[model samples]
Target chain A: MLVVNTEFVPGFEVTKVLGLVQGNTIRAKHVGRDIAAGLKNLVGGELKGYTELLTEARRQAIERMISQAEQLGADAVVNVRFTTSAVTAGAAELYAYGTAVTLAGGA
Target chain B: MDGDAATFNFLILLVPIVLIVLGAGVGGLTARTHLRSLERREAELTSIEVNNLKFVRDPGSAADTRMVLGQVVIATDYFKSLATALRNLVGGEMRAAEGLMNRARREALVRMLEDARSMNADEVWNVRFGFSNISQMRGKQGAMQVEVFAWGTAVRRGASA
Candidate 1:
C-alpha cells in the first residue's frame, strides 16, 4: 500500500522483490476543452483545462499501478516512474511503472 | 453597395492581423509577470536545503524519508510558438522554447521545495525530473504544450546522529 520513488525504503529491508508492476491509460481530447485550449493558446497563460486533464490522467495511471501492486501482495512499491507519449494527434498515453517488493516487517 | 462590400473585405483581412498583434502583446505581458513571480519564488526558496546525492553519506543520521512530487504544465503563446515552428523547420536550437521550458522546470522545483518545507524536511535527496508533451490536436498548427515533473525524497532528521 505504500509507494516510494527510491529503490530502497529507509529502515525497511526488502525481503522479496515480486516483479515490475505497471499501468497505462490513453485519453483522447475533448471537443470543448480543445476549443478552450486553442483560445488560451492565443494569449498563452497556463491552460488550466489541459493541465487538469493530464493531472487526472496521471492520477488514474498511478491508481491502476497501485491496484496491481496490491494484487501481488506487496508491502510497498518502489522506484516508481511515469512516462507519457502522444500516440495520436488527439490522444495522450500515460504510463506508471515500479518494482513491487515485500519488506521484512509487515506494513 | 460597392463601398459596403469593399469595407467588409477590408475588415475581414484586418481582423486576423489585429488578433495576432493583440495576442502577442497580451502574451508578452503574461510572460513578464510570470518571470517576476518565479524570480521572487526562487529567492524565497533559497533558504531551503536541496541535494541530488545518492544517499546520506553520513550514516547514523537517522532521518525519516518520504517521497515528494511536484508537477507543472505550461502552454506556449502565439509569438514564441511561431518562433518554435521556425526552429522546427530549420533544425536549429530554439531559444524561445528553451526559456519556456526553463520556466516550467523552475516552477516544478519550487513546488517540490514547498512540499519539503511543509514537512520540516531539512534536505532532499535523489532528485529526479521528467518532461512530457500533452494537449495535442490535429487541426491546430504550431501548438506546443509541455509538462515538467520533479520528484525527490524529503528527509526529516530524527536527532539520532
Candidate 2:
C-alpha cells in the first residue's frame, strides 16, 4: 500500500483503476493517554506514554484500511493518505485512503 | 568572620532564589503541557475535515473517470459522546479521534474508486457520497456502529472530469 497526499502516485504509472476501497476504526487511547500525561506533567520530560498511544492508534487504523482494500479485491492501493479527527471529546478516528490500482507500465 | 558570612548568605540569598526558580519551572512546564493538549485537539478537528470524501478525476484515463469516496464509520455517536465526556474529565487531546474518522472515510472512497476501475471504466463521473446509520438497539443499550460510505458512477471519459 503506497499512500500519499497527492492524487497520483509518483514512481509508478497506474494502469488500471479499481473501484473504491476503505478501512476505519474508532479508538479511546486519546483520553487515557491525556489523563496519564496530565499526571506526568508534574514531573516532566519526554512524553513516552502519549507516543505509545499514538503508535497503537496508527496501527489499528492501518489494519482497518487493509481490510477494506481486501474487501474491494484491490491488488494494490496507491496514492494513499492519512487523516485524523476527534469525533467526540476523548475518542479519536483514524483513516487511510488511496486509489486501488493495478500497475503494469513502469513510470 | 568567614563562618558568619557563609551563614548569612544561606539565610538571606540562597533560599529565596531557589524558591523563585522552582516556582518558575513548575509554571512554565504546566503552560507548555496545556498548550500541547489544546493543539492536539485542534489537529484532530482539522483531520476530520480533511477526511471528508472528496471525489477527484483520474488523470490517467482518456475517458472521464470520476470517483467519489464515502465510508461506514462503524462507531456510534453515543460511544463518541461517552469517550468525549471522559476526555473532558481527564483533559485528553481529541485529535486522534478526528484522524481516525477521516482515515475511515477516505478508505471507503478509495475502495469505491477501485471498484469502478475494475469494471474497466475509463473514469468515474458525478461521484457522490451517501451515508446510512446502521446503529442497532441491544437489549438494554444501543449498539455502536456507523458505516461511512462513498458511491459514484463509472463512465468512460471522452470529456474532462
Instruction: List, residue by residue over B108-154, the lDDT tens digit for candidate 2.
Output: 55555556556455444344444323222111223223344554544
Off by over 4 Å in 2: A1-6, A30-34, A42-46, B1-161
What lDDT tens digits, residue by residue, belong to model 1 across residues B1-161? 99999999999999868777866899788888989998998898787677776564342353666677777878888777877888898898898788878888888888888888888777777788889776453434576777888878776776655
Which number leads on lDDT? Answer: 1
Q: What's the TM-score of every candidate structure?
A: 0.87, 0.39
lDDT of 1 by residue, A3-90 (tens): 7677777666789999999989998878898788788777777777767877788878888999999999998888888888878888
Clashes of each: 0, 61
True lDDT of residue A13, candidate 1: 75
Task: State how far residue B112 of model 1 sits from its true place (Å).
Answer: 2.6
